[model samples]
Target: MSEEKNEITLKNYQVKIQDGLLQHLAEFIKPLWQPKKIAVITDDNVGPLYVDKVEAQLIEMGHRVVILTVPAGETSKSWEQVQVLIDSLAQNNFVRSDGIVALGGGVVGDLAGFVASIYMRGISLIQIPTSLLAQVDSSVGGKTAIDLNAGKNMVGSFYQPNLVLIDPSTIQTLPKRMLVEGYGEIVKCAALVGGSFWEIVQKVHQPADIILQAESLIHASIAFKASVVMRDEKENGLRKLLNFGHTLGHALELIEDGQLMHGEAVAVGMAYITAAFEKKGMTAAGTTAEITARLAQVGLPLVANQLGSAAFYRAMLHDKKIKGDQIILVYIKKIGEPAFYPLKITELKKWFEPILNSQIEDN
Candidate 1:
């Protein structure tokens, strides 16, 4: 409600953050795309809340709308689900000219986006990210994927959406835990950028504070990611910085078996890696403590003390960032100044040994 509406233009698409964008879905889609059919992919949880309204708007426009609902959770991001969605699209007689509307959280966005990318060798994609996690991070980036047993986002594509429509008001429906899940990514963005954004984020003492400032915070997070995506669409160089906590975060996610939310896992990854790198003289002094304090302020976990170091290492080996014998890790020289360091796979265990051991001893 702060601004009511704001727009950020990216290279291939535009992100529209509006207070009641959901009600105006048809108005927005008319200008961008006019497919014969629009497949609205969502989850059971969100379908009951928003899909009927979305379908009604699309139908009012004389466009055929199909509602495909998956179960609500990370498990929905799988090959099985992907195939199910793909079959749904095909069975509905979807074609290259048809479009897809991903109408839920990150899981829905990624799964539906992946389907949109491959169905008929790619169709139009419009992302309507309802959750904070999707609005701030995943929805804008165009990175679509389904998890493999080996790792997160193992099977995916850099398929950008034609438009990203964010409704901040929808976040009011999210539970406190889901809202905090989003802060993980928002804090990650602030730590990476290290300017006014970081200052604004640092002052937030709790999840309620973020909700009060949701509009501005969501816009800032999306704008930062849009800039990075524009500069490095393929994540070739500078874009790698966006993976700040993702390397070990994905590993921790795999180890916990979905016990941790993506943002929570990444929060722990960012804290632990920064601490380890600071000890090795790779990160700036106090950077670890600063990042830790900010994460804790938002109620994000700082470490997975119960998990062992070896499990993380094994999981990290499957990381996409691994090239040859080294895996690229992003570290903060300080808040707002992020740098990438590619540590040899052989040396990874040695680097994290003390931190892992101490965590076990403390337990």
Candidate 2:
């Protein structure tokens, strides 16, 4: 994708996904002005690979750097680990006025930014997202959270970043499976509000599509999210649409008990939701099949029999979208336009039987 095309205009945040974003890192950070000190928070998975480069870039620009490394992945997003990070900073005599730089995928970004949010009540957070998943979805939003065993992202905060530093060069090293996993959210964005971007998405799913063409997809997904987050930074309304496939998708993840990746479950979840929409006579006749087939083509299953829909529904009750105990789902009225529905538990239960069975068969 052309660097020019990756310039995304969010409601308030500026999300730049171009190739040379790092070339102007100094300029980007300049806006934040000088800080007493800066901490580069990363995870085990990412620290060894890109930490030196990121840290060196900052130091060369005359910033005091402290590197904090956490164990990689989701576990890092826990209150326990967060406390450890806080204690570490305190022990190191870091001040509240200092800023933090998060340089990894979603887990690192979420955990680090979250620490910055509560540390001394609030501080600056700079997101230098390396993974495609973070660049396209989690990195920019002030929405930060840690996972709970009962539910993913059960505890968190919404603290916007002071600056977002994206470098497509970092995405080149992403594993193929992880890369494919990241696309689930992008597809969710497309299904909900992609507009003409969906045409490109459909092509990308083809087995013949080249992986190197990811910049185009990444930019489109970011643009989609940028629009939503801008309208509803607090997630009161419009931003909920981005959860189109996430309701059931998240439930499936809980049901599997960390067995399925976020994106994989979302793939199945989107299929199930589209199916329900078709059953309600709300969707185009072929939409369900087309959606399922596309997910399948991309190696994401339409059905996951790992856990029954009954178990899944139980998990749904705990979702943030649930009103008390009822499911107020984020569903698509049509592509590019989203609707939030207050669905009765009983009403949703009706569709689970078939969706559950279908998921089993797919698995």
Judging by lDDT against the true structure, name the best candidate: 1
What digit string (tens of lDDT, one per residue) describes model 1 on residues 174-284? 988889989899989999998899888877888888888898889889888988888889989898988999888988889888788899988888887787888788778
For every candidate in turn, the CA RMSD to the true structure comes to 2.8, 2.8
Query: How many clashing residue pairs appear in each of the predictions shown?
Result: 1, 0
Clashing pairs in 2: none
CA error at residue 44 for candidate 1, angstroms: 0.4
Error of 1 at 59 (Å): 1.1
Q: Which 10-residue window of candidate 1 scores lowest in summed lDDT?
A: 354-363
Off by over 4 Å in 2: 1-4, 9-13, 20-24, 206-210, 307-309, 358-363
Runs in model 1 deviating more than 4 A are 1-5, 358-363
